[model samples]
Target: MEFDYIIIGAGSAGCVLANRLSADPHISVCLLEAGPEDTSPLIHTPVGVAAILPTRHVNWAFNTTEQRGLNNKLGYQPRGKTLGGSSSINGMIYIRGHRTDYDDWKALGNTEWGYEEVLPYFRKSESYYGGTNQYHGTEGELFVSRLQLHGVTKDFIEAGISAGHSHNADFNGEEQEGVGAYDVTIHKGKRWSTASAFLKPIREQRSNLKVITGALAERIILDGKKAVGVSIRQKGKSRQLKARKEVLLSAGAFGSPHLLMLSGIGPAEELAPQGIAVLHELPGVGQHLQDHPDVVISYRSPDTSLLGVSVSGSAKIGATLWQYLRHKTGSYASNCAEGGAFLKTDPNLDRPDIQLHSVIALLDDHNRKLHWGHGFSCHICVLRPKSVGSVGLTSSDPAVAPKIDPNLLGQEEDLQTLLKGYRMALEIIKQAPMAKYQLQDIYSADALTDEQLSEVIRARADSIYHPVGTCKMGRDENAVVDSHLKVHGIDNLRVVDASVMPTLVGGNTNAGTIMIAERAAEWIMQDQATA
Candidate 1:
């Protein structure tokens, strides 16, 4: 098969890219996804995230290398392996990070990525249900709305305010510091993934677009210095698809870097040891890994209103499910993590360095561990960590999982920040509104000393599902992609995904990832126009 563009990984970015690039009738675009189509009913239900997160069903349940920082525990990395990618299986919270995140990118020589310049792209991908404003859009494909506030979620917000934090209705608004309900990517009663937002509406109408699922991209087919096609394996058969214009990698942070290395375009030493010939010597193919190291503080709540596996909880869910099926409202339509906050560890910091998620469930170890009764949990993560890690080849085979080492909490500063955030979470729980719901403390106490609390943090803290910077975009020596998202020393190849983020954003990365694709699609179109 041949096309003008071949986009690998039909994830958050690829969906948007396919929609925008295929808009012109003159060009053809083929999108390759390693996973199956998003046909599962669980994918569209807002509460189905609980069932999807801990299993391998439509999820690339990858595991990180044992980190010495976490006492040699292998952390779990769950990525979406279906059409919409992580957006189909994520928490569905809509966050754009801090404005300074983009400004910092501009400072790093990416002049087009500054806050003022990228805001339009951010607005372009969102159809804010709250109506359009200076910072939001009302006509975009992706739906952003406020979920019906749960009683516990409202109480959590009240507790935050009582704890001296300000109440923010929109974290993506004038400021990102405050405790409030989050804006989620939900429409009506369903989880509005990129597939539903961007691809679904245009899939049947666009004859030039071809979406191939269950296609594992083995490597990019390079003709000398230029990328011309992709070799893929599907249904026990190997085939090659040609790209007449460009090959865009939107396989996300881990998959993009892994594919680049598998295609002999990464560090020489790493590929050579894996028996892969190096076609290009890009030392930064998978360096500078960053993620939000999160620690959850949970409590056993007698409030049957919260989600759990107990009898009453199950009964409540059954009723809510019926309500959702009928009216598209109720607790079943919740994202679970209905409320959150962004705050600074140090009061004098210019922006929030820590983020909080108030989950209406007893979430332990990414829901890998379950409890009997109803409860509430709060997740605290350092927005930016000083520690950096890398992604490397485990083998030359594309099917083999990459060696992911986030090196979370490898730096003392990260641990300190998490410790402070943990303390802040405890303080909020102590407020009357939240304290009333606490039946028993399931994690730690406020009286724990700094040393004791640090140990607790080190033992429990892991990723909050935000990972970026493996294939960072910049003009620095380690940059894999330039400001236009084109590979530094490659032709007709660009990576449009979270992997190109020069730095980790201050919040959830879904909104930012979609914005990146919107901006890249415009540039790609502009280049095509000139060509």
Candidate 2:
């Protein structure tokens, strides 16, 4: 079968691409997703994200090799496998990151990628609950909103107000350096995933857009040096599908680079040693890997925390039923990461370098216990990590996981920034308003000194769930893609996902990734018209 465009992953980026590209009615687009449908009840029920994290059903729970810097500890990395990808299973925090983050891309020679240029595309895809603005779009497909109803969140907001930092009305508003309960990708208390907000709504009308789930793309079928199509395996059978115009790779940070290398488009030195034929000899296919690693600062709460309510025996179960019956609201509908802030780690830095996520529950080792009590934890993450890593092919086998080494905390600056963030978090907890909540420091009471805290930070740092830049786009020779997202060494082949980020954004990658795809779709369509 042949398609005008074949998008490899039906994730956040691919969903937007499918919609925008198929809108022509003349063009036929086929979107393939390796995971099953986004039908998990846990996915839609915002708070269910915590429950879905450890499961293999919707998440690809990949772990990294031991980091030599972090006392040889392996880090747990989770990628969404469902239709909407990570947007469907993530914490649902809607953050676009710093404006300068995009401007930095322009400085790197990507002219069309400045913050002001991409802001419209960001607004174009967002259906903001708040009215449209110069920075926010109101009539777009992706849903964004403030919490409709939440109890613990209200308390946390008050605590922030008492903590001395500015209480921001909107994190996506005029200013970003304040504490506030975050806006989320939810509609009427249910998680509005990319599949729900974009793809599902227009599925039936778009007969030209065909979506295939449970189909894993093995590699791009190259005709000489060009990506002509993809070879996919599904139900124990292999099928060949051709792309007439382009084979767009939206397979994300992990899948996209692997497909490129499998199709013979990576570093020759690396592929040759793995018994894989190198087609393009491009050395930068998966060279720049980045992610935000965070450490949890937890305390024992003197009051009833959401964790206690959700985990208590019959009373907890009864309260959930009661809340659900009354207003379709309860702990079941919150996306866990209710409170967040983008702040500067130090005055000397150019932009806000830290992000904090306040959750009303006890999260010990990724929430891996049935134990429940009144507890609170704030996740402190360095927004701009100095350390860089890479993603490489383990073998020619499609089933093998790609080797991911984020090389976290590789630089002295990264450690110092994160250490400063940790200090600021403690300061917030000690403030008048938060102090009234009777938050007792529990994680490291034994390590009270600054030097001891540094040890604690290094020992327990984990990902805040933003991973990007494996196949970076720029004007440099080592760049894998051009400014327009087209592969550097191939024609009619582009990577339109988080993998192409030149640098990790100062906040969540979901919003930035979706905007990239929205812009990429326009670029592809406009190029088609000109051609």
Question: CA shift at 114, candidate 2, in angstroms?
Answer: 0.8
**Candidate 1 residue 93 C-alpha distance from true site, Å:** 0.5
lDDT of 2 by residue, 412-448 (tens): 7888888888887777766655655577676676787
Q: Quote the lDDT for 524 in model 1.
A: 99
Worst 10 residues of 2 by lDDT: 305-314
What is the C-alpha RMSD, rounded to one decimal, of candidate 1? 0.9
Which residues of candidate 2, in runs, are more than 4 Å off? 148-152, 309-314, 435-437
Top TM-score model: 1
Q: Report model 1's TM-score to 2 decimal places.
A: 0.99
What is the Cα-based lDDT of residue 289 in candidate 2?
91
**TM per candidate:** 0.99, 0.96
Q: lDDT of model 2 at residue 291? A: 91
